[model samples]
Target chain A: MNSFKQKWLICRTVADVTYKEWSAYRTHSMVSIIVGPVYFMVQYFIWTAVYGDHPSLGGIELPQMIRYFGATALIGYLTMDFADWNLSMLVRTGKFLTFHLRPIHHRSFALFQKIGHRSLGFLFEFLPCLLIFIFIFGVDMRPASLPWTILSVLLAFLMNFYVNYTIGLTSFWLVQSGGLRSAFMLVSGIFSGALIPLDFFPHWLQMSQFFLPFQYLAYLPAMVFTGHYSLGGFELSIGQAVGIQAIAVLVTFGFNELVRRLAMKQFTAVGA
Target chain B: MKRYLDVYKQGMYSALQSAAAYRMNFIVSSLITLAGNILFPLVTLLIYRAGTSFPGWSLYEVLLIQSVFTMSNGLSSLIFGGVLWTTMSHVREGSFEVILLKPLNPLFFIVATTFSIDSAGLFLGGVSLFIFSAMHVGAIPVLYWLQFAGMFIAGTAVLAGLTLMMAAISFKWVGNSRISELADSVLHIGKYPLPIFPKAVQAAATMIIPVGMVGFLPASALLGRMHASDYAAILPCFLFLAAGIWIYRHMIRLYEGVGG
Candidate 1:
């Protein structure tokens, strides 16, 4: 009970810092806000062309496709943690010490801060555009069904926090994570359903997704909203997401310790 | 002209050296380009299977147009890769001044400074995929390859023009490339045959943004689907050459020396 309040205060502190970091641009924050939907819109535009030739595509008609992708656009953006900087960046620049100066645990701080950016960013940037798309397209966003949607979204939040922080820890060893980040984008583009649904992939790719942790990050939650999977499947996806997230958090913690001792022990502060 | 060659040679040498230093990054950057081209199309193809025969072409023809676009894009990235990100940095930091201070053409120097040799990977990916798609369409006559080579050069010019035009806009408050991002989304259209779109959309894509000129028109010429827009080639072809030169001058005019 005593430690719980301490953690809560740290989470609140990190959230404030993240909001300030992202709010640096008042109007231009729209760039990042539109990024998700615009990305999805691009996917929708071409897929619409292709589907124009067919009456139904994998059980998704034109309206459904548009509606589904629109939802995907909003959800994907909200789940993203752009603050997932390289641990190596912090290490190389000696910025991690700043985090150490505070009493907060680095991983929890990173997660909550990223989540704060997501909340503020989604509210300001994506919500208006998303609402417009919803009305313009007459999207059937069943309000009654939102309870499940919220739960799925929570799982997605947790999973992304794990994935971002975990992958960010890899920067400790790599020194500069720009290359790693780009590679991660390529992998995520396929597995995260940013490019296309994992269902569309060949049997082997779909099978491989079970072993790799990409599907739970963005794809599964979006699918739940689209109503592609049954309640049971959605539960399974959430379960898998929770499981993978736990593993990722453990790995990130380990990597954090490894660098804290082996690599970072050699560092002298430039500021000093 | 002699001075320009010397500049070009020095730029190429420095680029090569920098690229050699970051071998792992170069390889990964290449794979990123390849995966970007491949993944979405493969996914779209799944939906295409459920859709109509895709306006009159097969999966292979659609793949052909995309490969051409990727090749052109890859070529540009190879030539001006480093400077792609330079636009953001320059705009944000007001480094546009140093670009103006150089004795040589500022636009030329700015572009040459960051030659991301990472495009060599893209070039290879493009060629291999082009041939792979071509074989699926069947071995074409030798004249086809010659014309492909020529059109490819045109395609490269068009892509570079589009990107440079976008970059030049960065001269003014980062030029809200919202339009360019929307334009870049045309990669989906590029991956498909043109007729897949509504006639009006096709016409608009041709005239307004001239995206059709990048991959579609030349691709149609290759697949033997020659249409009026294929002749639209002469527009972006000469237009890009002329527009690119003008944009460079415009960027120079916008320069307020931060280089001191």
Candidate 2:
């Protein structure tokens, strides 16, 4: 085989190994699946209270809002990335040196491994849970623009992965990214609109979402899934969302590649 | 008790040295925590700005609950976090034997030895929020201030107790590491007004989980939103602490060490 095909095969094998590895942790994966519904349950009551005697709040009806949250839950599970954790750990423990000896790029290897891990998790946990939620909420679950939405979600995953990979590379210098990790965990839930709909945010902040990549992680996809964003809704524009997400993937990946090159120059393996 | 205090003082002194050696990491970690805690209140600020208020909850009232939860949870995690994680891991690895070899209570030693300075970022963020929201909450009687302090401490106690209990359960339940995450989800719910939840969830949050007292109930008492019965909410914290202690003791007896 040519070198390119050989590398691709190796990356594919990494994904397979990671999928089987993650599949062993049945109980851990099950927690979020269990927790997502309870979250929706709490959201159900909270929204009911917010919408009492009213048809909608902020232009979203109760059922639609609940469905948005349900979709957000599924999309969240699907797009979540922890490549930074793997990178940080490998750097901290000096295991990253081993990657230098391997022909495949570390970033490519980690990305493929995560793709495998998330695929198994999406299949075993998110798919069934989302279907059940669709039944419970009586949501249509049908996309207004299947092709565009699929493209948007694919870009969403790429953007999310590169963002994490960049953060993970920081460990090459920072040595301990645990604090950064916790901080990211806390901030992303809100910024990504997984905690609350970005539509409910103030106008300027919602506008800022057009500039920030975080919204592509959950908000944009969920909105696309809910068909809330038509070709153009209130001037924010679906075309703009797609444009920004595509640009974000390119810009973030460039940043990650630059960081990797710089960090690799100074990298010294200090431990076994 | 004095001996335990002395041990804790020594442990804290050592922790400070460790902090000094990794000063940059320590500072960055705290800043991260500070940033995280501050971002949630901003989310609340925007939600209310969108003209969608949680019925019966003014924006400031919700901020007050978020503030209280941050302070109580931060304080508990800062103080008991060492005990919480170490105890669970030690039990799992059968390293409880090493803890027993020390001439002190294993729980107290664990709690004392592990002082998380990083939580100070969260605690400070909470204080900032509490002070900022207090300006809008209006003047209150001195008694209400006292009531607020009492309830806050009690709420922290309940949080600490719940954490310890979950750690203890991890010993017996194997693969129950996620129980602590479950507890966290409960506290996450407490970020909003408890009254907004269904009666069943509210009841569970009050009696079974006692998470309501972790923040919402205490803030409500300060706001005078609680009923006569709600004043007794602090009563559950005592029971939770007692149960936690009892369970930890029972689990220690059952610790057979890590099996081959």
Judged by TM-score, which candidate is best?
2
DockQ metric for all predictions: 0.40, 0.50
Pairs with steric clashes in candidate 1: A53-B52, A54-B52, B82-B116
lDDT of 1 by residue, A25-100 (tens): 5445576444554455555666766666577755456766666667666776677764447455676687987876
TM-score of chain B of 1: 0.86
Candidate 2 residue A82 Cα shift, in angstroms, is 1.3
Once model 1 is optimally superposed onto the true structure by TM-score, how far is the C-alpha of residue A242 displaced, in angstroms?
A: 8.6
TM-score of 2: 0.91
lDDT by residue (tens digit), candidate 2, B1-260: 78887898998898889999989888888888788777868757876776767888899988999999998888988888766677777776767789888888877878889998778888899989888887888887777788888888878888888888877877776645666766676677777888888788888878777888878988887887768777677788778878888888788788787541
lDDT of each candidate versus the true structure? 0.65, 0.79
TM-score of chain B of each: 0.86, 0.94
> Which digits, one per residue and each the tens of the lDDT, describe model 1 over residues B48-87?
5544546567787877787777777778777765554676
Q: What stretches of model 2 exceed 4 Å from their correct place?
A: A1-8, A135-147, A230-240, A270-272, B172-179, B258-260
Give the Cα error of residue A166 in candidate 2, in Å: 1.4
Which candidate has the top score in DockQ? 2
Best by lDDT: 2
Give per-residue lDDT, candidate 1, residue A98. Answer: 86
